[model samples]
Target: MRRASGSGAVAVAAVLGDGARYEAGRTQQTVRAGQRITVSGHGCTVRQICAYRVVLEPAAEPDKAAAAAAPSSPRPVGGEADGGFCFTTNPTVLATASKGFPPRGDTLSVLDNGGVRRFPAGLSITVSYVDTRTRTARLRGDCAAVAVADYDNARVGDTVEFAGVLFTVSGLTERAIRLKRTST
Candidate 1:
């Protein structure tokens, strides 16, 4: 994978099964597991995403001849042509209050995913009160309560909207909850 010049988007080289190589183009699309993308008109579902490589599975039968005969020109898909990264589309982690921390403030590790995950310093919810037992959290942005997670008890795969951004609860643990941003 290579970063596009001046854009910072990731560009990958797609190699077909028949040894045909082509540039998959630069995409700023925040893809998640199970999302579909088209490479040179061949549909593929994103299987797994790592820091360097994105694994894709064939979503439909490929037009082998078409892919092989196509030019090596870059084709943009999924993301906008504009530059700059969009943080709202990626997965985010939120930490729950542990044994003895007060329900307020924004500096504790246990209350902020061990300080490993944050909302980019000034965007989205800045402070949250999470209940590990109930698996819920009261998210606050700029001292105003913006969202809560008690409507459905914050189970895995549950979705919550915080500060106008929709996110799916992709993972949950005693320490943190993983939220993946969704188009909806």
Candidate 2:
């Protein structure tokens, strides 16, 4: 089966001394075991390299179309300022997950995901810290980075403001900042 995007897996077909042979399109490479390499649709650490045909699993796609088709919140009669990425008739619905953030930050991977790719430098985004228990936007910010386009200005300890609330930039990447709500 073909996947619309992302990498697939590959397997070895022949044992050639120190490596195994696999055809990634027209090009062939003898990848040794334990090598960290990426082939056309395949990538990741090679768990074991031996003679077996590669089996490619289809790339998993998120069902964004359905979510996108969900009824949108109505626009205000008069636009509301300081309203960060409003999506519900109610003002407290959390958007971090639909916007591609993890349900919660285990460490800083959440920041890196947004910073390095989804919300890259120069792109303005409305950010909020959602408390998992209540799933509400505790602190919100409408922001742009002050430095280069990769969002490298965001470091582990800086802070920014949202509607008078001070949220600390808890994690970062070259293009994104991960924040946590702090008592102000």
Candidate 3:
């Protein structure tokens, strides 16, 4: 195991003693399995993260304790796709309406049984009845045509690109699109 000792604000990470892996911010991957690691920098903290698995571990036989405890077929869900931030498929989204519209910051929720545990962002859908004679190029979509625009197509994970606002999708509904507050 190898270790780097530092006392400063910058992040300085390293292995513990022998056969440990430390590559900057990517991951403290150690060649030695079950080797403990210690990270020291700015706010030095220790979090015991599950070792990354290369192959899926399988479930053990119901009758055999040893087999049940040690199976190599599956691993935990959510890999590099989840990035780092934890999220839920039915993440509650909240959005505020523009002036004269419904109160903003309304919350919405969706049910996904597919273990869909990902909430990217929400979008604010504005519906307006366009005059057939008048052509609004910018405000031209199936959503802006009817008096009551339905957000049926809006689903979780779909990027809601707006002219002025950026949001992470939380949930979606026929009448509303769930959005979480975020930067521009």
lDDT of each: 0.35, 0.30, 0.25
- Kindly provide the TM-score of model 2 when superposed on the true structure, using C-alpha atoms: 0.23
Higher-ranked by TM-score: 1 or 2:
1
| Candidate 3: C-alpha lDDT | 0.25
- In the range 46-160, model 2's lDDT, one tens digit per residue, is 4453212222222223222321332243222222321322221222222331233322332223322222323311123332232333222211222222211111123344443
Number of the candidate with higher lDDT, 2 or 3:
2
Tens-place lDDT per residue, model 1, 138-165, is: 3332211111112224444554444234
Return the lDDT, model 2, position 159.
43
TM-scores, one per candidate: 0.27, 0.23, 0.20
Tens digit of per-residue lDDT, candidate 3, span 15-128: 332111244444433333333333222111233211111111122233223322321222213333221111111112111212112223443332322111122221223422
Model 2, poorest ten-residue lDDT window? 1-10
82 Cα displacement, candidate 1 (Å): 23
Ten-residue segment with the worst summed lDDT in candidate 1?
Answer: 81-90
Query: Where does candidate 3 stray beyond 4 Å?
Result: 1-124, 127-152
Better of 1 and 3 by TM-score: 1
